[model samples]
Target: MSSYYEDSVTLVAAKEILASLVESWALFRLLCLSQNLWAQEGCFPIPIISATPGSVIPWNESVKILCWGTPESYLYQLEILRNSTFEVVEKKLGFQEKAEFLISHMNTNTAGRYQCQYRKEYKLSEHSKTLELVVTDIMNQDYTMENLIRMGMAGLVLVVLLAIVIGNWHSHKVPNKEDWPDFPELSRSKHKCQTGPLDKALRDTRALCGKAYCKPGNKKTLPS
Candidate 1:
């Protein structure tokens, strides 16, 4: 039978090479219980951190942070992630390879995430990525809104004043008919003056002249 079909195809290639060597020895025993196995055997380097006046702060002020590491390191540590693990908080012990921490009056429960590590004698390293932090202010926005409101009010007042002035001017610009003299009365007074006094005087003078000139129904002779 072809030697039992070649030993069942060599026992199915030796069970696929013993299941790939038990999945690489269980990933090398989970990286030897990991503590960042000396930065995964690159020999320790992974430390860095940072935060000094940045990472957005403003509630109560004060920060610092910093980390660096690896010049033979020494100790360091720093953590702070809460509710999801991290913890630690402080340790120190370095110097020329940096370490600092500070954190004075912060607030809002000290913001959030952070990290840092280092050790160097029995090796530790790896753990500097996270950072986050934050706090804020809205004073600027408030000032801007207030200024806009003031400007709008001023403009409205100016418009109202202008309207008042225009209305006043219009009221006085036209004349009122009642204040003028009547045209017909003026014309009648002028006609009366032209036909009065002089006419009466001329009539009286004619009468006197008529009487002196002759006696009615009488005749007279006179000798010189």
Candidate 2:
């Protein structure tokens, strides 16, 4: 009786050990499957990123960056790196499947490559393809053109004003009559207060007339 009882107890203990081993193996398999599923979900798809108004943007213009990912992803991270300096310029976090980042005014400093990644629970997805951003000097270009136009207009105005002034000055000048050449007919009437043939003839004629006209009663001789 005692031997039979001991064998029964031993058999019961063996069965319990087998059951525990089976349970442990099943749990291990379940844990592995869970981990594998999580990893597969994390790596299935990558995020997609794009820039609004194209990659090349004008200076001082607003720019919008969009990041898209699977709906399962509850969080996203956006990053920007400047190619010239090889430095990270921005990092942003978003809680939605789609994220948007806005740069109010794009500049040289804000121009570079961009990327994004998604996270679900503790797993992170691969970063999206690189998107390049280029900021152009549109403002400077316009300003230079405007300056040239203004300069040209100013120069033309100055030329016109100078021409008008020259014309007015020429028109206001008065002619000097003394600078004119003398006429032959007017030379005889002109007197220089010097004794000449004309003057002597006139004096003799005046004396003869006085002598002929004088009467004896006057007796006064005409002075020569």
Candidate 3:
């Protein structure tokens, strides 16, 4: 009876120890899972970097470099490299989730590669994909060429219209000789009958006979 009591006590103690070990293992696993969850939540995600009005900017114009995809209350850092070189031309810091770095009066020196990263407290995210900035005066040149083409076309149209108007005026001013009637010609004998020396002499002889009237029978018919 004494040996059975001792064996029972030993069994109970062993069971209790085993239970404690199992509980400890489970607690350890739970602690590890919680730690992992915290680590994941603390880590920062990669940000997106881009330029407003496209990557190709115009000279002496303003451009906006945007950094997005970050959580609120995070800080952002924008960095630039000229001509893809290791040298950094500019760096800017921001506090908003969506940050903007404005380059006013951009010039040749402003053209280069740009990248951005976000940070939450001491944790920092990986740098975003590089964006290229190309500054040029080609836009102005294209505008000038377009204006010249428009002016030239307008001048050509004006010349064509003026030619049409002038042609119409000239055509209307000239009379069509073919539409006029032909005048009849008079013969020489017909002209002489109308105004000749014989006609004039007959008119004078009739006038003299009327005035003579055998005046007082004084030999009025003398000189032939």
Worst 10 residues of 3 by lDDT: 83-92
Q: List the residue pairs that clash in candidate 3.
A: none
Give lDDT per model, in order: 0.80, 0.80, 0.79
Report the candidate with higher TM-score, 1 versus 3.
3
Candidate 3 residue-wise lDDT, 21-137, digit = tens: 999999999999999977876566678889998888778889999888455535777777744554544444555778888899777777778888777676667788999888888
Maximum-lDDT candidate: 1
TM-score pick, better of 2 and 3: 3
Better of 1 and 2 by lDDT: 1
Q: Give lDDT tens digits, candidate 1, residues 6-105.
A: 9999999899999999999998888876857545567677788989878988777889989897677788988989899999888987544888898887
Candidate with the larger lDDT of 1 and 3: 1
Best by TM-score: 3
Residue-pair clashes per candidate: 0, 0, 0
| Number of clashes found in candidate 2 | 0
Q: What is candidate 2's lDDT per residue for 160-222, written digit by digit as tens?
A: 999999999988887579956786654543645546998889888777766745655776666
Each candidate's root-mean-square deviation in Å?
A: 17.2, 9.7, 12.4
Q: Would you give me the overall lDDT of model 2?
A: 0.80
